[model samples]
Target chain A: MALAEPKTTSQTLWIERVPPIWWALMLFLLTMPAWANDFFLFQVMGWTFILGMIALSLMFLAGYGGMVSLIQMSVAAMAGYMVAIFGASGMGDISMGLPWWLNIPIAIIIAAIFGTLVGALAVRTEGIYTIMITLAIAAAFFYFTRQNYTIFNGYSGFNLVVPPSLFGVDWRQPMPFYYLTLGCAAICYAAVIYVSRAPFGLTLQGVRDNPRRMAALGFNVTAHRIAAYTFASVIAAIGGILLVWQNAQIAPGTAGIPAVIDILVIAVVGGITRPIGPFIGALIYVLLRTFSPDVLLAFGLSGERFKLLIGLGFLAIVFFSPDGVLGLWERWRTRRSRERDPLTGEQK
Target chain B: MTLVNTTTAADRLGSVSSGNALELRSVTKMFGALAAIRDITLTVRSGERRAVLGSNGAGKTTLFNCVTGDFLPTGGTIRLFGEDVTRFPAYERIRRGLRRTYQISLLFNGLTVADNVYLACRGVSRGRFSFIRPRENDALLTRSDELIEAVHLTPWRDTDVSNLSYGQQRQLEIALALAGAPRLILFDEPAAGLSPTERAELVSILNGLPGHIGYIIIEHDMDVALRVAESVTMMHNGTVFKEGTPEEIENDQEVQELYLGDGHE
Candidate 1:
């Protein structure tokens, strides 16, 4: 009977649909620059948002599209390289000194095309084959960037590739960069949420569930998969651009195998099922990578043991809850709800 | 049927075609040393209702797959509405007003019934990749609702497909095939696991389809098949064994001794 009721009016008021906790979280993030120190704002939160955005792209492909692509980090790196080569950079001879407006869009478009090409190759396969194919492609990009000196600069990459001063605001400054990344990350998160319910996203999920059925329904499954990669690459490309601006540098190691794998780890550890999961995973990863060294040194152990600590934590979390932190949170919430009396809201 | 608007592109194509909804010439599918379907030649007229009857391993499903372009025929050409589509992909064929249902339910388990039907409706129509969610008055949304109601799954419209019962899933399968404006449909065992009541409802639904749309059903249930189909083509060992009216096929001595006498009921 409830299904018979009109859903439009209720759906239109999406602001009211968000939980109160999310509003509080947004408020906290908006005011973070006032309370957070420079190191925390620029290094910790900025890095978290940048990495989270990239992981979010991976989550979009893996969670919704049923494609666990390892090429996201490489796509992001490609964007970063494009910015360095096309925009002003320390490598004055190699950099063409194009306008920021021209370079930024060029960077995103190139990365998306690369991603679409990768999708064309990878979508021909399924499941584990997809992962292997994407990984191989990512590896190829890494090696190419490392060996090609003319365009990519090989070992030493371009630096001084800072964000352009727009409206007299130096965006590379801690507060501005934090806000910039925060704004971009929020837009990406909201966009993913919105598109997940759109026709394209719904059909992508259908393709994931049953490609044959989707074909029978008249959907070009391969084309949909490729389009998904293009969409994801744009997000990853944005994140990559922000990353280069934050560090004022771009290098082959930025998109190396370890870095590419880290994006996958971040997506999975954050619970690749929902859009927020990638951000949550990135926050934890950033916090651990930032503070765990000092934490280990305080215990009189070598700071290099931080990787061991991270590995242990990753193992424990995965062992306990394969869906990641979001899964655990959902389980706890459901359990709490079940314990409460439905009519009176009293704990049982 | 309201689903089959006469002015639709598929109907227009139907009118201009040679009137054969589907034509297969010397179609053959081979997997290594074994031939799944061999030298199959068949034709169905526009708006014709035909049932393909066979026992297990009769290549009925394989033949359906070949026609729908799920599996490419190793040898012959398949012409849908007078257009040779032997090299066309599954979606290409589907876009040319062809649709099919699987023997086993191939539904989006994570999606709701309404979403599933809406996807089918979107697949055939324009703006399939639109980022905007459908508004309440979206034509496709209304059509999907009509399809859901047509299949009698209105109560479960918001229910996830995985949560639906077998009979409900079967109904949804039929609704999916009927989406958009299909000029030809291939049904692989629509009543395989349905309850008797559901089978009767399915028969009624099949019979009630618009006259411009044609379908070939692969069925093991003789009663359900004969009731809905005007003609019957019996397959044995990947080849056409008999072809006649349902009554003629039922009374034929070879069909009875080889198929019916084997207790297929």
Candidate 2:
């Protein structure tokens, strides 16, 4: 029998310790202020957290599972519409009147089902075909929602939504709401990290690299890809729930083409290779979308130019760093380290 | 425990005395009127080292593909341990202890060589869906280490597969096939791009493996084939033209004319 090779010191160390810098960063974020007002807590931070979570779901499929999907936000919108229709406000509300717990799980499950169907079909093809199929599916769902008022309430949409409440505390309250969003985002982020390092994650990567070889090694490549999509949908669906509660409304606009594109932009801007890439991108996006109009007004620019500025930012980031903000940050750190220590200056 | 885990290395090797690890009975596959491999009936007995020799379009690779479930044969049956597995999917056949190494190294380039072997041993220790971390499988880690050591690649085990030399990469590929402890290993041109010395080393290693690990090596290198394989099957076009000991094949006038063409040089 061949003997086991001894692991190197670096591998051994990485296996043993979780780096201290990450912990320090987490503590710093935890101590930051809840926010000075609802605008910061609920509107800006809340949207960022939810959009970031949605983008993170795409990251799981694209980066880890080697699947590109344009329907993640569309799936989220399905959950949003489902919640509105099923919650105490819309069509199902009057006809069925189900409790909050039952409604939310059903919304997520339905969104997951929608996501699984999309995944099963998209996974049949690869590369550009996968992208096209997902885009088509998202577009079809958007049109269906826009035209059907009885179910999705048509283009007029649905309103007067409420998040589940516990102990008489409105979880949707600005501060409480921000915490809830953060908590969910944190869990999703942690789960992505854990899964990426797990055996299944490595095997998924292996499948992406060489599906035939992986198949011969006993991996059901299609099954893994679909499972990955399903996992991504679960997170996106939760983001959708939080999003509807935040706006107290659900609309066809939420599931439209532009919203679907925005999720992709967020993933690209954050560096789709890493899970936290979405969060970084989400912060930049939410800040821009929230303040773009005000910033344009200050510059004597009209509302029409707000989108132009956002577009320019996207172009600038992509042009300067194809991997997005995370890529730029990595490059900057490597350059700084090289300047400080010329002996060992290579970047991974 | 052995019966429950029929795919395990010990279980597969234990059943070697029962018969050939793999049997192909009149297997044929066609793609649009072009017969890739036709009416190929072959048996690779347990503990046997068989070499399938042919030139470029002799369907050597095609036969390996059919055996490994890369493609289902259009006709006839394939048996693993006296049981028909003609319609099994690639993963299912692999689970039944049948594995193959590709002509081009199909290793995970981004990961370490050890990680490549670790993946092959992954399904062995636990189910394919095991959530256990790579570090948690000490038995697998030990097995992978043994494979790396057996291939004399302990020094480069931790290095990325991309960083290895061509010969080392080929060796690592074989190591990966061995990692799963398969009952039958199909090598598709194992010595394809290796140096003469490297080819010699591969033959030695192939010869050294225990009797339980049956192999069907597809090769163009006659020297390597003669050294390692216990039996030889020569193919012309897509069908086997002759089968016997290497000496018998070397002396056969028909094999020389059809497969070798003109001279034995």
Candidate 3:
């Protein structure tokens, strides 16, 4: 049944496929340390990257797999706890004092296993049930870590849990730490984007859209979903390690219910539709969190009302742009394009 | 009259050796007290084209669903290619060379036509969990492209499935079913909601399929069904009323009285 005209398009070079705007953005991020202050570099951007990575994991599950797992924050906390327990920490009785290379991989593996187990349990149900199951699991982890004194150090966790010195550089230093978190976030972002078009990612999307259809096409829907959790957990695990290093501590509150919900808010606000959405959401969240207290005080409100402010902002975003900031941006772009004539490039 | 009650071991052996593509014995599906289909038995040989025809509520779709493992039969066994797959999951049955298209278009609407075909091809093959994007020259990619062409959807390859017309979507449905080395495919109302021109195109596509790939089509369109199918199975109230050659079923007095009526279309 060969057709006379085979309409296969010629493949373009990989580098040429990337738009010019991404190059400009990469350059700006890479050179930020040159002009930005130490506090901005170490605290604001560093926190943004860490949160972004964790939220990216959530976005991957929610956007592609149709599984809005609240367990990602807990998974990150698990990694953070793993690092503190496996590697050096102020709590010598709790810490194992393993080497960085060993402990880091161990921590990620443990968290991934935890995520896979959660996935296994969560995927047995569908839709709103998935959210509830994951939330329950996350809450359980938070409580377990708080109560388990021997393993988790109880409510008060390990402090001085810094990153290992590598390449003659103190990784805890602001500049180095920024680059570290940035590098990790970049890798996670790129990996998510690359994998989205791959068979695994595409099939996950298919599973999300029509699970029965995917199964009929010979795909094990449950397995693909569980595998998605494993992939997402690794990224969240990296973010957790980086987060613990940034704060120099890990507490039960680090992965508390509030923190877990905050990640959901961040992912939703930034837009869960694309990989870049989580980062944008994270950046907005970090900026608002960092400056909103002062802004609230300036407006004659208590600085402690930051959560209220965040809640209001979240409500506003949800009310206006249901798909988050990315959806708003897309709408704007489409409208702009529609205004211009394709043949002459003149505004209609 | 080869109605030998095959044992599980013998069934497994005979499935492959006996040339039977599908075997369903006393298959039943119940939604609470209402039995959608009950005690339905069916058999189709390898490389045989068959049409399952019934009036609305006759449980033709339910029968397809039972065979495809979308709905586990309430009681009884379904053997695919000789293996007892009664309790097997849909994906397991699919991997065993069974594929099905939904009565309604159940496609990845957000994805492109090429992506949809590619996913279907990748489903039954190895490396389904691959994290690498298929290269231009990848075997599955080439196969997907060929299937798209076979369905005459080459021009709309890059278009999103949601953007495709009703006829085009129906065509894409057939393309998806044809992916991989499917031995037995279940097409549920594939000719439904298609234009007359599209129906002819679909008939041609069905007739042009490789000889060895057998299919059981559920069609309301008599002309299209009678044209593509060599044999016919007429169902009445979730049970097989008659099974005979297309000509025999077409001229049958009971079928005409029950289904076609006096002025048969």
Candidate 4:
């Protein structure tokens, strides 16, 4: 591991060489719970990371593949529902009482399969049509889960969905759960980054950029798009598992239209093109959701109206910089780099 | 056991069946009431350099599209090598070593020149389905760099297609066409937007390519068309009007009166 292989530009962009900023951020996240109280650790930062993971999955699809999938939350929520139903948690006569080993993989696999199916149906469509098809499917799934009581347990969703005990520790406890979420997020982040540099990911980006050109160059464009959805589904499914653990519940609202769209907002707000942008967007969103209520109250507005600020923020970001916060950062960096070295065009 | 033996023998024969690189027999394409291409019977032998020369709206581009499977011919059979690929999609044609450049450069403008060529290389390579292997490590990607050098775009190799000059994009476009290890390549209006110098460079590049690469060039520039192609087919009003060597077509009184012999030439 110590002997480094010389890397290409794409390899350098990947997880091969972890940046100092990322290292500092990871260290801070790892040690945060020790100093921070339960509310900050579990409710604030932990939930933020879970949402961030969900958004990151969306980012992976839209950013690299030029595919905007609205069914990402549906995939995640499907996994959450799987955890509730399969692993000894659902209400009377609903739970399957399967082992954790079976349930977890089954949840992820099913979500991946569902995502691929959605991709297959939507892959041929472009732009607005793709968005509409995915949105419609997500809405249909939401209603199906909400109305179907026999299997899904209906409007009053399943509760007491606890994580299994492993290594003599109650995995759902605050510190452990936080670590579990952080670890999964880190692995998923690395995997997404790694895959973006991988052959499949690069080809996918080509397909996204020019599907016709890609197809003419001998690539199976539909297959690549479907495969991207499958990869994105796995990321979302893992986040779903963490979400059910964090909240100890699963509901149709988990996959509802607003939640699904929120994932897209987080991705776009952070920077749809950058891997870390979705998480940063998620952080900004979570911070707003957490404290905007108080800020609204001081302005003699209802706490529920905090959502207005979020909406406005989204509009402002879209209007000013369509690429999101990351785009702004990139433009600024380029200008600075140009000022520093006109001849070389080197960036810091 | 007999079936297995027959299959192996057939596969061996199939690898190099007949020397014809491309065969289009009475191919026609109709769009609504208009026939875009009409009974285009053309055969390109292995290592053949041919030109499809005509005025604008001669259906040369349409013929390229039909042959490349951008759109299926309404009438006849299109064959690649020995295989009947009339019903094959564009991508399938590409997989079978049939490649073409567009009249308008259809490149991934957001991606780098290296990335563009890398994609072209990856498309035909056996590891096209590899999910985890980084493209940077692919032996084919290294080969794509050589293609960049071949087209004289090495200095702009890492630059984005959108940022490149029109001439450079044209160069990358040709590089991409060559990246697929194609046995047959259709160059559609390769000199469309190029300066005279760039046009000469393109002609030189085409000249330098391996002779085994069967090239069907759709060129408006008679100088370039005459220089690169040994034989020429002149199309007028969606039909082949004249077919002969560059000199024969140039000197033919009928061709001069009807099309190429006009002031445009």
Identify the runs in model 2 with alpha carbons over 4 angstroms from their true place.
Answer: A1-21, A34-37, A90-97, A334-348, B1-18, B124-126, B132-138, B257-265
**Candidate 2 per-residue C-alpha lDDT over A163-261 given as tens digits, one digit per residue, 9 for 90 to 100:** 878988899888888888989999989887766656777777788788898887767788888888888999999999999999888889898899999
Local error of candidate 1 at B44, Å? 0.4
| TM-scores for candidates 1 onward, in order | 0.97, 0.90, 0.95, 0.91
lDDT of 3 by residue, A1-348 (tens): 111112443345668767999999999999999999999999999999999999999999999999999999999999999999999999999899999999999999999999999999998988789999999999999999999998998999999999999889999999999999999999999999889888899999999999989998988988999999999999999999999999999999999999999999999999999999999999989999999999999999999989888899999998999999999999999999999999999999
The CA-based lDDT of model 1 is what? 0.90
Q: 1 or 3, which is superior by lDDT? A: 1
Q: Report the TM-score of candidate 1, chain A only.
A: 0.97
Query: Which regions of candidate 4 fall more than 4 Å away from where they truly are?
Result: A1-17, A90-92, A338-348, B1-16, B135-137, B260-265
Interface RMSD list for the candidates: 3.5, 5.0, 5.6, 5.6
Candidate 3 lDDT tens digits, B166-215: 99998998889877777778989888888888888889888887787789
Cα miss at B198, model 1 (Å)? 1.0
Runs in model 1 lying further than 4 Å from the true structure: A1-12, A342-345, B9-16, B262-265
Question: Please, what are the lDDT tens digits per residue for candidate 1 over residues B1-265?
Answer: 3855445435544433787989999999999989988899999998899999988998999999999888999999999989898889998888778889999999988888989898998888887788987777788888888999998998888888889999999999989988888888898999998999999999999998998888999999999999989999999989898899999998888898788675654
Best by DockQ: 1
Question: Which is better, 3 or 4, measured by TM-score?
Answer: 3
Which of 1 and 3 is ahead in TM-score?
Answer: 1
Give the alpha carbon lDDT tens digit for every residue of A1-348 in model 1: 122224754456768778999999999999998888999999999999999999999999999999999999999999999999999999999999999999999999999999999999998988899999999999999899889998999989889999999999999999999999999999999999888888988888889888889998988999999999999999999999999999899999999998998898888889999999999889988888888999999999999878777777788889999999999999999999999999999999
Ranking by lDDT: 1, 3, 4, 2
**lDDT head-to-head 1 vs 4, winner:** 1
